[model samples]
Target: MEKQSRHIFSKVFTNAVLIIFSLSCIFPLIWMFYSSLKEKRVFNADVVGLPSNPTLKNYKRILENPDYHIFDSMFNSLRTTFLSVLLIILCGFIVGYIIARVQFKLNRVIYFVFLLGMLIPIHSLLVPIYIVFKNAGLTDKWYTLIIPYVAFGLPIAIFLVEGFVKGIPVALEEAAAIDGSSFSRTLFSIILPVTKPILTTIAIIQTFACWNEFSFALVLLSETRLQTVPLAMKQFSGQFSSDYPKIMAAMLLTMSPIIIMYFVFSKQIIKGMVAGAVKG
Candidate 1:
């Protein structure tokens, strides 16, 4: 009875702590959201207080106004993020599978080279990358940010996929081989289905990375017509310092997609991370 009481007390204590922590983390987001509904004067008058009269004017202005171009920025961000995530997942799985399953002399060398990328600081290479892009005439292109996004994203993607693939039984592949399944057929049909969880996790991770990436986007892109969400948000702040409510609205708009994605895929993310990290 004493031990049972102790366990119950501990559970209560942990739950209380967790509830507080969660509320603390979520408070800023809630504040930002509600604050977005207020006018600039209201927000300035009482930053922490809730809006007594919420309005959709900020949202309408940003979305409906041709000058803001919020829609265009969203489209650019979506396009780059979608393309980058797709390529990262496809290439990461293929290369990681090869490195894990194949026996070759240069495998370790290639793996080492890829791993070297993660160790290097991206900020250190900005000047060099800019010079290279300038000389190559690749700057300001639609695909400029996509290249680095894929390149930087690949190392971690490959690492996770390689580890997860290693955890999968070799017997599965061997059994498929015995059935006279061609190599491509076995890889795509037999092995691919088994890797869904880890791949989903990789996709989510790379999506967040590509979407939130600001520095690379800033360095690689210049045209207002081609601006991504991060760049546009930054520029928005500079252009509308007085309009606090509109700024908050713009931030909320930018945050909505990622927030929705996280809530939907939250379970898959936790499961995949645990499986990939522990199983292998």
Candidate 2:
């Protein structure tokens, strides 16, 4: 009975802690939503309490405004993110397979070269990258944004996919090879099917990274027409102050897709992470 009481007490303590943590994390989202809906007067007067009269004006204004081009910015963000992730996944799959399965003398060196990227601060290379992009006549172009995103994102993607590839048994690939399947054929047909979960996880992570990337995009892209959501949203902030409600509304719009994606593939992502952890 004493032990039972102890376990019950522990459970209660854990529950209380978790409830507090959950509320703390979610409070921001609640506040953002409330601020977005509240009248400007109420928001300025008292931010903690509920709004006296909630209005959908901010959202409506956003949708109705043609000049702001929020949708265009969103489209640009989506386009760049998709293209970057696709290249990363394809290249990552090939390189990841080689490192995970094939044993070559230089394999470790090659893996370390990829791993080296993560250690270097991206800010450190900004100047060199800008010079190279300028000489290549690629700055201010869509490819400029996509290239840097893929380059920076490759290391993590390779690491994730390589870990997933290790979890796959060698016998399957060997059997396919013995039957006269080419290396490329075996990898695409046999290996890729089994690595789908990890691939999804890698793709999703790359998507989020590319979507939210600011520093590189800010420096690389100059045209107002080419601005992404993160960059375009800066317009809402003035030199001295910011429009809190409109900004929050825009943030909610920008963040909604990623949140939805997480909800949809969260199970696969968790499974992939667990599998990769064990394999790596």
Candidate 3:
């Protein structure tokens, strides 16, 4: 009876803590969304109070105003994130497979090189990258952002992919070899299908990173036409500094897609991380 009571107490305590943490995590987003519907004056007067008179003016202003160009920036961010993640996944898969399966003496060294990349402070290299791009006349170009996004995204993607690849049984490759499959054929036909979960994990991770990235986008992209969502949000502060409602509305708009994505694929994300952890 004592043990049963102790277990019940523990479970109850754990749940209480979890509920508190979850509320803490979600409160900011809730506040931001609620505050977006309020008048700037109302929000300033009662920052935490429920909106007494909700309005859609903030949304309308942000969406309809040509100066905001929120939709265009969203499109640019989406385009860059998707293309960069695709390249990262493809490169990560190929490199990960080679490191996992190939028996070359340099394989370990190559893998360590990628691991080392994760240790390097990305900010430290920003000046040099800017200089190189400036010299090559590639600044402000879409590919300029895409290239660095892929390069920085590779280390984590490769690490995850390699862990997943190692978990796959070697006998499957041997069987494919015996059946007269070429290496590339074996990789595409036999390996890639099994790697979908971890790939999904990589895609989600890289997508978020590329989407939320500000420093690189700010430094590399100078043209207003090429600005991403993060940069567009910065504009609200510059011109409409006191318009808290509009800024909050813009933030909710910017983060909505990612939030929806997480809700939809939350299971897949958890499964992928667990699978990688077990395999690795």
Q: What is the C-alpha RMSD of each candidate to the true structure, in Å?
A: 1.8, 2.1, 1.8
Clashes of 3: 0
Count clashing residue pairs in model 1: 0
Model 2 over residues 57-115: C-alpha lDDT tens digits?
Answer: 98988889886788888888988998999999899999989998889899999999999
Summarize candidate 3's per-residue lDDT along 1-280 as a digit string, tens digits. Answer: 9999999999999999999999999899999999999998899899999998899999999888999888888888989998999999999999998898888988989999999989999999999999998999989986778989999999998998888898899999999999999999999988998998888878878998999999988999999889999999888875545688999999999888788888898988888777655656
lDDT of 1 by residue, 113-206 (tens): 9999889999899989999998999999989998988999999888878888888999999999999999899888988888888888888788
Order the candidate numbers by lDDT, best to worst: 3, 1, 2
In candidate 2, where is summed lDDT lowest over 10 consecutive residues?
271-280
After superposition, which runs of candidate 2 have C-alpha atoms over 4 Å from their true positions? none
* Candidate with the larger lDDT of 1 and 2: 1
Question: Model 1: runs farther than 4 Å from truth?
Answer: 239-242
Taking all chains together, each candidate's TM-score versus the true structure is 0.93, 0.91, 0.93
Ranking by TM-score: 1, 3, 2
Q: What lDDT does the true structure give each of the candidates?
A: 0.88, 0.85, 0.90
Best of the candidates, lDDT: 3
TM-score of 3: 0.93
